[model samples]
Target: MFCSLVFCSLCFWHLLVFGNSDTVKTVSVSVTDGDTITLQNNDSQLQDNYLLSWTFERPESRIAEINKGARNFLIHDGVPDGRFRDRLKLDNQTGSLTIMNTRTTDSGLYEMTIKSKKDDTYRFTVAVYAYLIAPVISSDSSRCFSPLSPCSLVCSSVNLGHATLSWYKGISVLSSISVSDLSNTLSLPLEVEYQDKNTYSCVLNNPISNKTTHLNTTQFCHTCAVDSSEGHANCCDSVEAVLRLVVTALMGVAAATAMFF
Candidate 1:
């Protein structure tokens, strides 16, 4: 009877070990972005029915229980700033998560835990990240300048956070500025003496985002005449008329002197 009891105990222990092993046959996952991830079911051909489960943990942290089902999944919703957020997905059919907008703060070893119908469990790790959006240049209006006046060139960001600013002329940097918020302006100094009809550009840059804005300067001269039709053939016609009047006055004086002679 003693030997029989011992044999029964050994068999029970084996059954427990074997049951646990069969539950976690395989585990796989997919990374979305800084905050989102997808877990996939790599093992389709399980010999027995098992409940798939998941768990997440940071380094040296306690395991957090996740959702459970035939295909189980979970997401880390409470992510901090500069970290990944709202970017994890799990496909029930395929058992995968589609991550979105990965960032540097999202970098960490993520773990996935699973359980089977026999109450067996398994775990795996995933890394997360936060991808930064580069800055872009913007202006209050596209047609910023009017005749004989200087307009301010403003630069802003589409997707930038806590970044420095810079101004450039083509390849060369003109100045460097900082922005506490998302928007800031670098106004170019305009002088009446600085009258060259040249195309100018101001560049805005953060480490992640970079962009440029163009500025056109308008000129007004005192000696310049205004044509009624403005920028048409009448402009040339008006200049020709003024030139003819000057020539006629000079020639009429010369004819009177020749008649006296």
Candidate 2:
């Protein structure tokens, strides 16, 4: 009875320590702020084996490799600087991979296959994003091409590394632009209908971060004008400019007639 008990205990212990090698495992990681990330295949018990081979598969790329015979670990050569380059680190002691300075192009599926007592595959999908800054809305305060057309307003962000800037009227987007590098700081233009009584806003965003600024039409311009493809109607000019002159002239004539009476 004692011998049977010992055998069962040893079998369960093996299962717990080694786990099911045939079963493939998956891990998901979200990296932000241009940080580093590490991926591990095995615990300390089987760390020295180096039986796992890491690969990037969405676009079919090579990542890092481990030799079972010499227990050597190295990141593959010829990978583009946009992919990994000198930023990859492999630990032979624990069979883990660390990538330094993660970028948007580094986002993809990474797979690891282990050939120990059983064949196991591990997959990691990495998503990297940068935080976006608040967008600014600027205009000349002069309606472009008169009041019938959309007033030209510029929405932009300054020195953003990787992000998208957008102009919005409520939930609808008028325009959006995505830039990885801030060669020019990025800007997008939109035409706003000042007489429409609708609120507008500027938005900057990424997969992980978002910032917004509401646009006040009063700050840019103060006239009510609706420009339609059918026709341009200057509401402010008709109500305030033309009628006010006629009404003032009529009031002067009435006072002259009253004094004569």
Candidate 3:
């Protein structure tokens, strides 16, 4: 009788260890660094027959447990571990997990399990993206005088991951440059009229970060003639605009001399 009891206990332990191994399923998750992330089941709703629980296996810890009945009780008072005690949130109704102010250390797979006729399980592969930095905008000219020239407003920055640099005129993007294979730095120059009246700016960005610098259009074409059709086009032809202004002035002086003679 003693041997039979020991054999039965051994069988029960083996079932607990290997019976539910196939129930662990994997899901994918991506979240911006320093942002809040929630892990939940999208397909199934909580029903009367099953109970819900969550486990974060990468940290080797039990995250949460919930009972489904009217007298629903939260095991471990809803906090299952020390690392997540301050920032973890458990939904009383759906048993979803929410992590606030997430960091790189928090990136890992999370699992949600339900005890029903068949044990249902879901896994999530969580990833936290790095934050981005703003770029600096520089000018490649000592002074932009009446003689219009092709001056470049250079925008550049160094950071991890991917980034894009762009030049804008008002609300519209004049041009954009992108770099993905680069480990940390990007730079681009947007050539434009070297006058104060032609407003422009440079912007830098990544998936999680954005930065911008505005051009002092007033410093570019300090003196400009308004073109009725294109707003500022007649004022922006670098060398041509200056040549036209000089020729027009000289012609006016010559005409005045002839009238006096």
Candidate 4:
């Protein structure tokens, strides 16, 4: 009875450790480019040596070629039409592959298989990633203020690199929390309202890269007219220009006006 109990405990202990070692064996996978991928074995049981192989599912093919005594190995198949070819390379030592210049069509499920001399086989799956290009702020320009003319600036995100757009002035943000789109119109209120021209800045920021750029200009007048020898132009032109200036300056105020009214 005693011998049987001791033998049973020993068997249980060996099974526990061996079962965990088998379960822990796996490989970490990543897609480097449209044509390249990397796979690394995570097993740390200190096994003697292992063979790594890959199989493509959708096309149903194997990359390994048969040789007399040597096991299957990864080789560059060259760039394939609508398929990753020249981009595939395998690092036997580290079990990694570099895919150069990835394309959208390269996305697919991949499988990595590892085999040991003892016939132990391990498999793992890797999912590829390619994020959609986000919005970006390309450039901004600003104009200084003149006695009769108000200051103005334009922020445009012609192409996208980052996401979520905003404008700022110094430490204080000039845009509202709701300001989150490209080519947003702005109106500003200067703390010091007077004839003396003050320097102001317009800042553009994107959420993804958290990048910001400032456009500086002299303070624009709130109720000023463009300098014209003929008393700020005749009634028609004067009204038109004044109306345009007011409209630009009032943009920022509109956000606060709703609360006040």
Candidate 3 structure quality by residue, lDDT tens digits, 1-261: 011111122212121233744455455555666788767654335667567777775444667777776546453324333556567777766666778777655667777788866776777777665566667777534444344465556778775455688888888987888876446577777766644355677888766567787776554334445678876544444566668789999999999999988
Q: For residue 152, give model 3's deviation from the true position in Å.
A: 2.8
Best by TM-score: 2
Native-referenced Cα lDDT, model 3? 0.63
* TM-scores for every predicted model: 0.35, 0.58, 0.48, 0.42
Residue 19 of model 4: what lDDT?
52
lDDT (CA) per prediction = 0.41, 0.68, 0.63, 0.40
lDDT of 2 by residue, 1-261 (tens): 010111122212122224644666666666664677777654543534446677876435667777766856668834644457787887666566787877666777887777777776767777776645688888874433334446667888886756888888899988888888745487898776747678789989876678999988777756655678648554544335556579989999999999989
Per residue, candidate 1 scores C-alpha lDDT tens digits across 1-261 of 011111122222222245424443223232323343333334433333433333344433322233433333344444433233455555444333444555444434453334444454333333331223433444333232333443444444443334455555555656666554434433333232235455455555544444555654342222234555665222223445667689999999999999999
For model 2, the run of ten residues with the poorest summed lDDT:
1-10
How well does candidate 3 match the true structure, expressed as C-alpha RMSD?
Answer: 13.8
Which should have the higher TM-score, number 2 or number 3? Answer: 2
In model 1, where do residues sit more than 4 Å from their true spots?
1-71, 75-87, 92-96, 100-159, 162-164, 179-193, 196-199, 206-209, 219-261
CA shift of 195, model 2, Å: 12
On residues 55-75, what C-alpha lDDT tens digit does candidate 4 reach at each position?
554324554322213644546
- Stretches off by above 4 angstroms in model 4 are 1-18, 24-39, 42-51, 55-71, 75-83, 102-111, 117-154, 158-162, 169-210, 218-261
lDDT (Cα) of model 4: 0.40
Ranking by lDDT: 2, 3, 1, 4
Give the Å shift of residue 31 in candidate 2: 2.3
Per-residue lDDT value at 35 in model 1: 41
